[model samples]
Target: MKKTFKIPMSILMVFAIVFSALNLSVFAEEKESNDEYNFELVQKDDNIVIAKATHENGDELYATLDKATSEITLEAVEKPKGLLKFGDDKTTKYIVKAETIDPALDVVDVTIIDETTKSELRISPEYVQAQLPVLVPVVTWGGRALLLWLMEHALAMTIAGITAYVATDLISDIRKSNKNYWPAWIRNNNVYIGGDAFDTDYQAVGWVKTANSGEYNLWARTEAKAKEAANKAAGTNVWHQGKPTDGHYDHYHPAKPLVTDPWVVKLDNHLWY
Candidate 1:
């Protein structure tokens, strides 16, 4: 009896050790998958260029520009709230700005004003599976055991469980993808110039489209002329007209030209053309 028990016990111990080793291997693989993404701020004349590259372990790398001079300073800034997602991939963001040096020369002062924020997401699925050899075998054995216990009902129960697990995992992945994607919200508004400094006022009208949200938030400037233009463009009869008060312009309307598709309007007295 002692010899018979010893054989089974030894086999079980070996299996347990194998499973634990497999789990540890999977964990190590996950750690080794740290790829560093690269981001850079390039200053060219008056323009600052922002560039990014995908890598495995971006968080461990220092975020700094190679071209750090008195005339130009590159700084990386923390990724903005709502701009970053958790556990997708490593990412770094930098803010590059150019300032005027003097009215004398064409040379402008360029600087990176903030430290880049670095973040790392979850390990890749390939690594997770590659490291865990025992997981699949264990799950398979469990399924087999469950089927054996169920006897006549085994097939149906096993299939249902697998289907449910797969469906749940699919949904979770979809949600995770959605969370990681970021959509840009572009806004353009007409800057109302009052007759004088006291009359100076500003109005903005545009649409906001978020990544997750399907609907757009259409809004027009509240100033009198802006409001009228927006309403006229929208072909809507509803008008909110008010006079200039507290050193601002009167009622405004949204312009139809601005609301049209592929909307292009003058910004800061400068046209794209």
Candidate 2:
């Protein structure tokens, strides 16, 4: 009999905690790396605190603190060019204000607007804690190991999945190109553009079926010519909107233009829109 390894609950808990911390650390690092604030506490004394602030993208914001009264004031020297998301959901836009003042010690006051509803929200460090998800360890069997493995190789898995999808799409395209083979008649029949000569109000109408189960793109010089061409091509004198009576040629159909020296279809053997 083969013995299966079952991870201990304590060890599983430890593994979960470690993985959670690593995941959180990575997310935090990414968020911090995207920090737009270049602001830092420069000087603090009994009377005042001064901080120089700049945006990562060159927009400037400055802050100052009054130590005696424990008041901090922040202001934007120049408005940030686009919208800025400060919270975790990243659905909020940081509103550019001329001034911001801290009401008490260890606290900074700021105004941010929700991007969707355009509602104003006042947020501080304390209220922002709820934005982070609480990491809880779930008990599992051998699957816990698989979870750890997947977490370790997430990037590789993602790349493999994308490559597979792209290869599938490429294969489909190749098969379609192979199936779009043109018949001998389509290859032989040359497009004739005669509408411009016969009448000023003439145009090319819909395609008519040919003798070889193929199709020929035809342009009519006038309404009478259009009716005549339809009758000759399909042995039917009826058109979609009946026979056009007015001299104005309203029944225009899409046609592919000739590409080669003999005005033939393109190499792909498909009609150009």
Q: How much is 47 displaced in model 1, in angstroms?
A: 39
Candidates' TM-scores? 0.19, 0.21
Best by TM-score: 2
lDDT of 2 by residue, 1-273 (tens): 999999888887767656544434334422322244444555644455454544454444334434333233333343323223222311122232212121212232344333345544443354443343322111011111221222122111111011111121122333344222111111112221211121222222223443222233333334455455444433434333322223111332222335565442221111211
lDDT tens readout by residue for model 1, 1-273: 455434577777767666544424335443222132333322222122222222232322222222212122222222212212233433333232333212112122223223343221111222233433342222211211121222111111111011111121122342343121111111112111111111111211222111112122222222233334344334332333332233121222222244675553322110000
Model 1 residue runs over 4 Å out of place are 1-11, 20-117, 121-273
lDDT of 2: 0.30
Worst 10 residues of 1 by lDDT: 154-163
What would the TM-score be for candidate 2 when compared with the true structure? 0.21
